[model samples]
Target: MIKTASKRYINNFKGFSREIWILAIVTLINRAGTMVLPFLSKYLKEDLHFSLGEVGWIMVSFGCGSMLGSWLGGKLADKVGFYKIMIFSLFTSGLMFFGLQYITSFWGLCFGMFAIMTVADMFRPAMFVSVGAYATPETRTRAMTLIRLAVNLGFGLGPAVGGLIIMAIGYKGLFWVDGATCITAIVIFWIMVKEKTKSPYIDKKHPDEILTHSVLHDKPFWIFLFTCFATAMIFFQLFTTLPLYHHDQFGLTEFQTGLFMTTNGVMIFFLEMPLVSVFERKNVHKVKIILAGSILMAVAFFVLMLDFWIGSLIISLLLLTVGEMFAFPFSNAFAIGRAPKGHEGRYMALYTMSFSLAHITSSKIGMEIIDRFGYRANWLFMGILGIIAALAALYLYNFLHREPKKT
Candidate 1:
């Protein structure tokens, strides 16, 4: 039985195109070097001695930069191509990371964070569009999950290694490593993947593809974006407040905090792909799965309200990781699946923008609430947002099923 299960799991990874595999490899390399972000808030607060409010503002700037980058990357990918955008974004952003460590003042760092993210986040939409181009509709969701698995694997390694680097050489070393990794990943990508103007895969027509109106006319898509934004806000707390809570509540060191985060990454890495494959194979409704994931996230936050035991932290993170495994891959597939043939970049950009916009507010609002009320208030607020998102998703599920089909 165990061997049978293992064989089934391995089979899920089969049938992907060569381009998809190369994209996953490039993603793994880049993400593995992403040690800076998970620890950025702690570095600002503890190392730079920035107040909570100032840290929030700096993060807001970072989000704004990400927002602009997503827009530009999407627009340019449509005009220029995903290949050029991916290479340019990574290489330029890598150079910026090396310079960012030199800035210390609040304004300087704020500007630095924003500028670097503007360049760095351009990779997201381009990468998403590339996945769409490379994978056929039948295998697209699994291909996406494979890429996500790479991301989580990198995240798993990044934090644990970053923690050791901080212990050995301080935060400055993280920037250098991050910069180097970005350049390395792009160079590898350039060598391995030749540029292509159009996708070789032919998309089969489906009823869902009938709603190919301009995105502005799609009320369900807008509602779906809002749901994504809310959940993203809740998720971004991992970088913002959750790390601080690990320290303040449990007196955990950076290494210990990193271990907790590593658990999240590892769980997602191992479980998300197979689980998403199962869901895709079963033809489960996307919004129903997303709503279930949202409810789990809200429960995870509420679990944090039981602050006495450190075990609650573990339990809460477990719930959150499982929720992520369910929500994100389906979300990726849904957004890309809904795009019209020529407007893929635009659709992906809007989808990514929801998370970018969430990043802008999640940190600032979370920090402010922590300052004025406390962590409990922030947790409660996040939980409420999760519930709202889940309700929205539920509505979307009903709306999509009930709406008249386009002939």
Candidate 2:
């Protein structure tokens, strides 16, 4: 019995051993460098004295560029190696970070943000592809959970550190610090992270194989994509609408809102893997878990709309974090599971694109709704959409789990 237990422990370690650590480190470094978004609007508004409208435009430009970048990166990863694409992305993004110091006008800020988001987004698909490649079916979910943990931990620490740095030196100091960290990550990737063998779906003789088979050729994949896109629209709203809700309704300060966001990252950092283990052992279907999480998330959003007394915002955030912990990593694993072996980069790229599309759509739509109807009305709309997405996810999960016919 002891020998059997020892062997089981060894197998578990072997599942994640070194490659996962390398990927985790890369995630940490990237997140640490890019965690200044919480303070970015403040810097633009107060330091540079940009109007709120101008800042909004700048953000839209970055999102547009990111959408283009994610698509291009996926295509490039299929042609060039994932490692090469990641290296190029990191270096270029680092350069863009350094260039932020020179932005004087609205156009200059827009251009700088565009360049930075484009290059930064390029690293995303490649990183997802690399993780898919490194992990096996049995361990892939846990591996992704670990990656999420690393990301949340990095994000949690990074903003706190960046906040302090901005308080001390200023926004320029934050930009320089982020730029230096990006360069450091690039160096680390160069020295330590090694690419494994390419997927069988990719052709060694002809790299153009990826372009030949369109992602739309698969029907189920499209269904999954739509589900992701819808869900993300609701998910991304948290960043924009939630804080405003708390501020207007509860009179919470920006610092308090930041604390609420940090709590999300903290929960994921500590609980994601354990949650994964628990859910996986339940023999529950992956899609059911996803559906449940989505419903919970939507409910959490709806709960926030209630005119509760003080501290209710914190409770709502906790509920949303719990739901997010289940949904996000599951989405990653499910997408990877559905991917054709060679087209991992393309699949993951498409998945990430859902996020970009959602952010763009949500910001535009949510803002317009907020303009017409107050924050409460806008959130009600989002909550309704979230419910629709949950129902759709459940239907898709059922469809995907249906039995295949014998030859």
Candidate 3:
């Protein structure tokens, strides 16, 4: 039984090509080095002497840059190609990370944060483009799952390592170490990946068919994008709100909070890829899975609302992890399917922008709820929003599958 299980696990990785593996490795390296943002809130509040309100504004600045950067990244990737843009985002972002350590004033930190995130966030759509460039539609979603798996593997490690770094040399060292990894990943990617003029692995489309595909006119894609935005707004509260909530209410240390994040990564790492494969093989509707994920997300917040205990938080994280494993990956598949070949970057960019928009609002909105109404209200609000997002996803599914009128 053990050998058979191991064989199946190995078989699951069979269809992917060398470039996909390289992209996954690059993601793994970069994600492993992503040690700054998880600790940024506590660093701002405790070390820099910023209040929660101030931190919220700082995050808003970061988000503002993220939105602009996402749009620009998508546009540029479509124009110049993913390889050039990705290398730029990685190299410049590493430098920005090194710059972050020097900013002490509130406004200075905000500006610095904005620069780092803007550069860093450009990598998202570019990475998605790279995956689309490499994989077949039948295998594309699984390829995406592999990339996410790499990220989660690194994510699981990053915070645990970050916790140690914070204890050893404080928050500044976290930035330096993270900066080093970003540069390292850039070097590896450049050396390993050769841009194909035309990929033989995936089927090709007629030039004219691609020439006309524009994301701006695609209504169903917009519906999916809005659904993504709503889901992200609720899900990202884990980043913007949960850390402080744990610290303030449960007295969990940075290491302890890191454990929660590690748990999230661990669950996704072990389960998401296989689960996605199984469900896809069964011909399960993507939107229905996403709706289930949404409900699970709601349940996660519901757990948080029900109790202040660490155990409750753990249960919530478990549920939220399941939700993320389901909802997030399929969103990409749906968007990529909507794009024509030439416009993959733009479709992905617009898709990436949805999450960036979420970042823009979630921090300020979450902080306001916590400060004015309290943390309980914040969780309840997130739960309610999750339900609404689920309904939106259901509607989008029906919209996409609706029968066309014969002209």
Candidate 4:
């Protein structure tokens, strides 16, 4: 029995092409070196001496850049190819962050943040395209999960180390380290990874191609996009407001908040692939999977609403982790599943823009809510939004896929 279980588990990592692993490695290095977003809120308020309102506006600028960049990346990836896009994004974005560290003026800093987000976000759509290009349809979801696993693994390291770096050196150290890691990842990808001329999933039994659908006209996708936007609006508070909550409410230091973020990365790293392997089977309804994740997200903030302390915070983090594990991979797979053969980048770009949309509003909206109401009020609102969004998603899922047994 033990051997059978072990075999199935090990097989989860098998069947992927070599190129997918290379992508995973690059993703790992890039994510591991990520230092800025987690600390950006703190840096703005404390280091730059910006008011919370200013922070909201700056994040909105970042959001606008991210939105445009994502759209551009997707459109360009179809025309130019994913490899070149990624290479340019990683190397250039890394260089830009170093300059970001030195900027002190409000307009200057806003412009710098906008530029960084624009460049950095291009990598996402390109990576998704690369994932689809490299893996067979049979193995594609697992391939996606494998890369996600790598990302989370790096995320696990980045923030914890970031906290320590903040202590050892300071915020400046974070930017330098972030730049170095991005460059390192770019080098690995450039050296080892090559562009696959074609996708591996062309076969009689399961054709990978789909009818090309317009993003605006596709009803299902639009529904999914709205769902993504809503969930991210609440979920992104982790980056924008939750860190501030940890500091202002509990009086936790930067290290402590970073340490809290580490739990998020750790849980996803250990649980995501395994859960996908065991439960996210070929026939499982992606909508059902997404709805389940959304509910857990609600529970996360609900836990926080009930109490505000170390224990509640830990529980909330765990719930949010599990929610992400469920939501992100499946949601991504669904988007990829819907795309036409050559336009995966565009479809994913639109999907990814959902989060970027949240970035535009989540910060400003959250900061406003917290500033006007109390932290508990903000938590309650988040919790309520979570439930409503998930329920709406559930309804949309059933509406979109009328057939029960369909993937």
Candidate 5:
């Protein structure tokens, strides 16, 4: 039975092309080296002596840069191919990281972070485009799962090592390692993957029947994008208000809070790909799956409203993790599936941009709710947002099914 389970787990990772594997490896390398972000706020506050408000502005600048980068990456990928954008983003961002450590002044650091993030985040949509180009329709969701697993694994590894580096060589070492990793990941990618001007793989099943002529006109996709946005807002609570709630309410130490997040990462690494495989194998509609995830996430928040019990936190986290496992990979695949040939970069950019925008707003909104109405209010608010997202997904599912398929 153990052997059977192991074989099934391994099989889920099979059938991916060599390029997909290479891309995953590069992503893993880059993400693992991403030790700078988690510590950025602390570094700015403690090391640079920046005030809290100043740090907030810098972070807002960073978000703005990220949003612009995402849009540019998508637009440029369609114009010049994903290969060039990926290479340029990584290489330039690496150099920027090395210099960012030198910018100690508030304004200098703010501009530096904005510029670096603008260049760095361009890689996201381009990489999504690359995944679509590399994987088939049947395997695309799983392929995205592989990429997410790599990301989770990298995030899991990055912080522990980053802490050690900070203790040994200080924050400067983090900058060096982060920069080096970006450059190293891209170098390996350049060596392993040959650049192509066009998508090598084609979806022969729907060659002429793209859902909409222009992305702007894709009404169902707009609803789908809102679903993505709402889900992200709820998820970002894990990083933002949820941590504070753990500390203030349950008396969880930073270390204990870290463990809760680790649980999330570990679950995603081990379970997400296989779960996606199961859903794909069953021929489940992506929007239906997403709607289910939305409900789960809503319930996860509502579970937290049971503040009388500490175990509610664990249960809520598990539900949230499973919901994330359901929503994110399929969302990626659905976004790609919606795009017409040669327009995938644009579609993916918009999808990624939603997350970026959510990251900017989720913390502010959650924190305000906590300040004004308390943690229970925040949970209720998030739960309601999740339900709204689920409703949007349901609407999208019905909308797509009702649209006449053009053969």
Candidate 6:
């Protein structure tokens, strides 16, 4: 039984195909590079002597650039190939990372952030489009689940490793390390992955098909997109409000905080694929999973309001991880499943935009609430919003599950 299980696991990874593995490796490396961001605000405030609001604005700039890049990446993926676009984005973003060390003024730093985010966002739609191209419908969700697992694993290791790097050499060392990783990822992708076929959205004879596949006209797609936006708002707040609450209310050290963040990724690494497979076989409704995730996430935040206790925080992390395991993969699967055939690039791009939009909006809202009412109020508000997101997911699922009108 042990040998059989090990064989099955090996086959599953091999079955993802070489292209999928390449993309997964690239994702892991790129995510590892982004480890700088979690500590970026602190780096700016202490090492660079920037104000809190200025730091927030710099983050907003990055978010805006990412949104714009994702919007454009879809079109580029359809027009050019995903591999080419991704390689270019990775290399350019690497250069931008190293360039940050040279920027002196606040505006220059903002521009650097914007440029880096734009290049980073370029990877999202291209990667999603490649996933769609690589996997059959039967394996698509599982493939994406594996990819998410890779991302989380990278997330788990990147910051912890980055923390050590920062302690040894400072923020400049962080940028240099990320840049080197990005360059290595680019070379690996260029050598190992080849674009095998044109995007389904783009026809060789009928070039006009590209112009016609607009996702905006699909009502059901828009419903799913809105749900994505709502959930993402709650999700992004985890990085911002959750950590601040832990620090201000509970007084956790940076190491303790890192552990709190790492717990989410660890859960994803262990539980994501098994959960996906279990749900794949059951008669369980996808929307219910999403709702359950939202409720658990909200409950986790609400639990934080309890008096400072290490046990509570650990429990809360477990709850949040459960919520993430349910919501994120299912949401990605549902979006790709519902997309109009041949428009996966466009659909996934819009789906990814929800995250960028959520980050921008949540940061602003969180900052305002944190400034006025305090961390508890901010977390409570996010928890309430998460519940609303749950309702939205239910509404969307029912709407999609309904019968279509006869032509």
lDDT of every model, 2 decimals: 0.87, 0.76, 0.82, 0.82, 0.91, 0.76
The parts of candidate 5 lying over 4 Å away from their true place are 207-209
Candidate 3 residue 274 Cα shift, in angstroms, is 0.8
Cα RMSD of all models vs. native, in order, equals 2.9, 4.6, 3.5, 3.3, 1.4, 4.0
Candidate 4 lDDT tens digits, 1-407: 99987776687788888889989998998998997777888989998899988987887788788998898888888888888989999999999878888899899888988888889989999898888888877677778899888877887778779989999999999999999889899999889887764465633245334443476676667777877887888888888799998888788997898778777766776577778876646567777888888888888988887554678998989888888888888888878777766777888899889988877788778888899997888888888887887887887777765633233
Q: Where in model 4 is the C-alpha error above 4 Å?
A: 1-9, 41-55, 163-173, 202-209, 243-260, 308-315, 402-407
Estimate the overall C-alpha local distance difference test score of candidate 2.
0.76
Ranking by TM-score: 5, 1, 2, 6, 3, 4
**Candidate 1 lDDT over residue span 1-407, tens digit each:** 99998898788899998989989988998998999998999999999999988997988888899998898888788889989999999999999999999999999998898889888988999999899888888898898899988887887778779999999999999999999999999998899888875565524345445355577887888988998999989998987799999999989997898788778877876688789878878889888889999999999999999989899899999998888888889999888777766667787899999998987788779989999999999999999999999999998988887766521
Q: Which of the numbered candidates is closest to the native, going by highest lDDT?
A: 5
RMSD of 1: 2.9
> Candidate 2's residue-wise lDDT over 309-340, tens digit each?
66557666777788787778888887766665
Clashing pairs in 1: none
Q: Give all TM-scores, in the order shown.
A: 0.89, 0.88, 0.87, 0.86, 0.98, 0.88
Where is the poorest 10-residue window by lDDT in model 2?
A: 203-212
Q: Which lDDT value does model 4 have at 274?
A: 79
Alpha-carbon runs more than 4 Å astray in model 1: 39-55, 102-108, 163-172, 200-204, 246-257, 308-311, 404-407
lDDT of 5 by residue, 1-407 (tens): 99999999999999998999999999999999999999999999999889999999999999999999999999899999999999999999999899988989988987888899999999999999999888876688899999998888898889889999999999999999999999999999999999876665545466423657778898888899999999999999999999999989988899999999989998888889889989988988889899999999999999999998999999999999999999999999888878887788898899999999999999999999999999999999999999999999988887887887521
Off by over 4 Å in 2: 1-14, 199-213, 402-407
What's the lDDT for residue 210 in model 4?
Answer: 44
- 1-407 per-residue lDDT for model 3 (tens digits): 99988787777777888989999999999999998877888899999999988998897887877887787787788888888889999999998888888899998988887878888888888888888878876687889899889987887778879999999999999989999999999899999889853344333442212223467776667777887887888889887799999899889897898778778877787688888888779978777888888989988998997654678998899899999999998887766656666676788888988988887788779988999999999999999999888888878778766624100
Ranking by lDDT: 5, 1, 3, 4, 6, 2
